[model samples]
Target: MKKERSFHVYAIITIICWSLAFVLSRLVMQELSSEALGFLRYLIASLVLICLIPLLKLRKVESKDLGLIVLTGATGFFLYMIAFNKGVKEVNAATSSVIVATVPMITALLSRFVYKEKITTKQWIATGVSFLGVMIITIVNKGFTISNGLNWLFLAAILLAAYNLLQKKLVQKYSAIQSTMMSIFAGTIMLAIFLPRTINEVQGISMQIIILVLIMGIFSSAIAYVSWTKAFEVAENVASVSNYMYVTPLLTTVLGLVIAKEFPEVSTIVGGIIILAGLILFNSDQLFSKKVRIKRIGNAELATAAQVIRESFATVANDFDLTLDNCPTNGAFTQAKHLKIDLDKGQQLFGVYLGKKMIGFFELVYHDGYQATLEKVAVVPSERGNQYGEFILDKARKIAAEDRIEQIDIGIIKENRRLKKWYQKNGYEIVCSKQFDHLPFEVLYLQLDLKDEVTNE
Candidate 1:
């Protein structure tokens, strides 16, 4: 616990340095072009990292991982620096920080497609909220128009998100320092195109700007990455460390006022609030929410349950191209009337509630004294990734066990390998598969023995 707390401090230190960079970069850019500023800043960072290599005893990059390292350098430093420097010059430090704060959400969104990570429905809403914040900041000044600076900043956010994904892969095989050092080295090499201009700019640079650039390079670029990586290593998960980024905008705004004497515009404050709201909501499951409860939903609540099922299953239907005409019996097409019929026929319906809101639903059918079936197990599309499905399924298993059922059977679309794996992880085994002529896809049947003591209680 002490180690985790220390890592949290490291993460905060990194964020503080990053917040300072937003303000200091603006100051340095006053006298330097974006290209020169990026080149000079990273050049100093690369030299600092090189000097630490021997002290840190960093390992050499493997030949196979060289491509990935270079890509990280290109995206994280080379491209991101250019865009960020230009954007910072055009926008206030507060606005720049708020725009860049969307990196975590963007990274999460990318991970959904790249690594098959699950995002809850709340997170989807949060992503939309953050983007809406960005849109407001972009158009607040010039009604319905976006500035070139905002465009560059948005691109920078995307490039950084790509860098995060690449870096995450590299860190698995290499130390954080080694991964960061190599990427910085590669990025500095790419920025070498501005070497002549950087040298020319340095000759006439003011001492104040020089000191600011040095601070940004040594503290923000080199030390910040090192500390950020260390925090990730010691923290329980990536989200724990990454959540610290939510405060970047607020910290940058305060730093800008104190250090750079640049107060944020009204739009920046408003937009930053919205962006932070979304970020808070995105992480609310970890921060604000209480434990979920599984309850036996009654007939009076069948209509709401039906809506939850339809919304949840609609995503599956859309994914597999199953329409009402082609797959009318699908849960996406379910109505309250159907649920009533099921209830009258002795089927049990349950809802997974987070406080008063129902986020998931499932039905259980007892086939006999020793057998049962699980059906329509659905979690609201936006409410996924919280393990609500697992919660509901566990409850179903317990209910079956209490009723002395020997086994529980379930069916899923054969093409949904992710779902299949999820069930398998929960002690379900494939017993058989069937191709129904009426349905467009093959169905795989899985069964779970209630006697297995490993069932999640």
Candidate 2:
């Protein structure tokens, strides 16, 4: 289904709800230990979801996929929660959140090796710069000190990274609700083995604390997830949807102002802005590239192009949330196109494959006068720090040379200053910056002068 205006409204509301969760969690923590709280939160979420299964009318799954699902549940859902909860016990809530915020960078790094996803040099730079912002918060505010005790937070961060990757994998096959429910329920079951320890902590809870915990369970765990899944469905890109998670901490800080009546320190606000800036760069096209490759259709390839543009897009309609309210597959195909261009150069499009699956794609226009413009290019969660993105850009450069194109222009959104600096390191120079008033974006044009460099070489 196409994302409507309603999805954006729901996403903002979900963020607000999630922001409040930190305040509630803070209060709940005074009464309950982290483990007890983690266990209980998932328990409520799972139980509620299970009760709704009949209404959801979910279908039975193949037995073969059960093991993968269980593994995902354990790593992504259960372990991540436990690690996060325990990490909070060792550090203040602010400190823990700062560390946890690195989840996206970690995921991008892991995705490269585990899933063989390609990332560009610009992406690694963005990831690094963005992570630097995270370090600023931790080192500047939290007092940079390490102890053997802090290992738990590291482990927790790793678990969180794994959790996100698992969610991505599972979301490919199952509806978000189905995947989330199974993982939550399975995770709840696995953690239930330790219920006795948590039971002992229940005696310490006051009525207020109990209410806070319930609210956290219902809103953050259950309701927020439903909204997140829906938001992801309608988002123009999955990464864009995931990027919204970076806002959680900002919301948390604002909520702190309301609930505790405590104004955030100047440093806190500064750090938050820096972090957001880095994330914008990290998430924007300066570090991430999306390409559509098509080819001239010979008689033999017309059927293949039909399948690529028409049928393949149809298959991912639900996954991509392009269903536009569950429109027919034919309706979905109507929105797709296969075009032929006339230019000084004759370029053909090739097949498009993501994670080894061929999907609908168009050709990269290679012409004498038309320059290829590159923009925000970030590594996915699992493919960071691997130099894969550089490799892709190198290939593009070679293609540019072959076609005798004048230059390649990449636009980095200004919100991501980190990526702009990173691009400088890779021989891309910023030529201009322009603001977009309607959207919260500013464009930074980085030009790679092939003619000048080629002559120098």
Candidate 3:
């Protein structure tokens, strides 16, 4: 369904809500113990979630996927929350958030080994720099020992990383909001086993603390997940969405300074810079090589093209809120679907090859009897900025002209400023904007109206 809410707003909401958890948990800690705090957080969240299930009309998980769902719930909530609460008891919220910032770098590396996802050299370098940033914050005021809650936070981080990966995978089949609700519910059950120890703490809680805990559960747990879940729907890669989380720590640190009055050490600031620098370098495409050969590829080439597209967009899965498998070229069911585009229907499947390797792939869809929609335009990470993107656009224009089509259109994320500007530079202008389902943002429909230009030829 099309959302009236902006995904970017939701993304920021999730971050701010989550960052507040680090501080809110601290407030609750004055009265409730760590385990009790964690339990109440989920319990309250579960209540709010239960109410939403009916309102949202969420789908129920299949019996077959029950086990995976439960495990993900455990990782996301039970283990992660308990450890996080315990760790936050020992450290300030800002420091805790900084340690948590290591999630993106860790998730990428873990995916490489576990899912066999390939990481580029630049990614590895970025990971190292980010890791160094994490180390500076964790080891500065206190040594690397468990005394300052580094061990507990470390454990919480590992579990959080696992939770995010599990959520990403599950969102492929399930709705993000529903799946998140289920995971929270599942984790609440696990935490229920320890309820007896903390059950007494609930009644004794002060009204101020009670109000804060409810806020955490309702906003951070229930609402923040809307963005988290919608991410997989919007982005082709998880990294694209998760990259925004880098700000969580920065925000938390600022909140800490202003609200909690916790002054950060110099090492903390330096580490934050290192982390930002690494992420910046990772996102930069320095390749000036635009020497791409555009051609129609055979079915034998689909798998290679698919892999290139997957690798090219793997970061989007991590950085963005969207799921990786949702891409037609990478999805389980659609990999073959694109390979079988009906040429007779005037649908052209094209590959952007650089020296025998298929670095980018796109489809010119001449369907619905209107414009040839240019779909799935992607350039491999290392080969971007080589004019492959423009090459695809030019090819689409040629095909549109040959087919006597009046328009060639492409849909791009409204938030992708650089790409949107690039498309404008190449003669495409936004004709319309509409909400796309599952995606958190609006898709701008841009077209090169070639009627007059083609007639001149």
Candidate 4:
């Protein structure tokens, strides 16, 4: 109980620190340049990491991974800071906060493209809604101008998204403290290029700026960055922890009201609500299904698996069949043969479950030591729209990785252009199209190479 409570407390603290940093930076920027403020903020945070080096008892990382760590820092921390520092100057606090609020959706898109994370139609709708909300707010606030400041903020969002996905990779390999420290170290180095510009004004700056920098450096940057990294390391869904950032506009608005006596307009409030609404809709489990990448199947589950296969392939069978007599998925012996081929050939047959019931099943029949064919794919008739087909394809990819299989092949008939396109989108490329003796149409043979795939999941 206490441990979970502590996690929530720390997570909330991290969000509060980050969200309020916008307001704090604005106040301090009256006397300090953005470059100096960002550099100093992270410099103090980097020092905190330096202090924790011995305490964390961190392990040494690989050379190749270290290069990625450097890139992560450069893009995530350094570039994000520089862009946001320059960008925040032009926009109002609420506008800046709201514009930056689109990070989660952008991150999701990056994950889809860079990491091949499968998103459903419903999830796309959510992204659209959320994006609409952002546009509405931006237009209302300042007539949607893509000026230097807004552009910089957009660039900051892109850099931070890049940083986050790369950091996700790092956390899988290194401790949160270790990766966070290295990233900050790299970022601090990048900030050094601008030292000359900010250094000259330092002597003339007032104590108010110095005090705010100290507050931002210690509490906001140092503590907040570390804690935020830790949350990513420990949370089941990094998305869930990150979703807390949506609260930033609200937090910033309240802080602005209190600290600067600035109140938001009606349109800003309405747009902000819509933005939150889009985010909420997008994460509504419509797009990124928990049903994918989690379930596993064995022979014991064959009966349920068979039923799914039966319901799933019924349309195709009906289109081709004069009778169901020879259809493998139609009956006791044929359906069980699908199970037996896996048993007999040292192949794999698995079902993806949604909750306790099986929604889909796939068969991977080994061709040789290096290759396997996707023998069958079926999603239960009742469960088609949740990207269950994509889920099974993803599961097949993971099985290939674990079994040390080199390539997974799928033979789609030339007539099924839609399925062919779907396969292309899901990381499968058409190796060749060839005529098959048994089938009347040419088979479009597609293969997904598992050699370079990063994750079994």
Give the higher-TM-score candidate: 2 or 3. Answer: 3
lDDT of each: 0.85, 0.61, 0.72, 0.73
TM-score of 4: 0.64
TM-score of each model, paired residue for residue? 0.64, 0.60, 0.63, 0.64
Residue 345, candidate 3: Cα error in Å is: 7.3
lDDT of 3: 0.72
lDDT of 4 by residue, 67-157 (tens): 8988988997888998897887766677678878878778889989997878779778877777777666557646756467778888998
lDDT of 3 at 161: 83
- Model 3, residue 284: distance off in Å is 4.7
Model 1 misses residue 347 by how many Å?
47
Model 2 stretches with alpha carbons more than 4 Å out: 1-3, 90-95, 141-144, 147-153, 261-271, 286-457
In candidate 2, what are the lDDT values of residues 225-290, reduced to their tens digit? Answer: 777777754543445456567777776776776785545555545665665666667667623545
Q: What does candidate 4 score in Cα RMSD to the true structure?
A: 8.0
- Looking at model 1, residue 215 earns an lDDT score of 91
| Candidate 1: worst-modelled 10 consecutive residues by lDDT | 448-457
User: Which candidate model has the greater TM-score, 1 or 2?
Assistant: 1
lDDT of 2: 0.61
Query: Which one wins on lDDT?
Result: 1
Worst 10 residues of 4 by lDDT: 325-334
Candidate 2 local lDDT, residue 122: 66
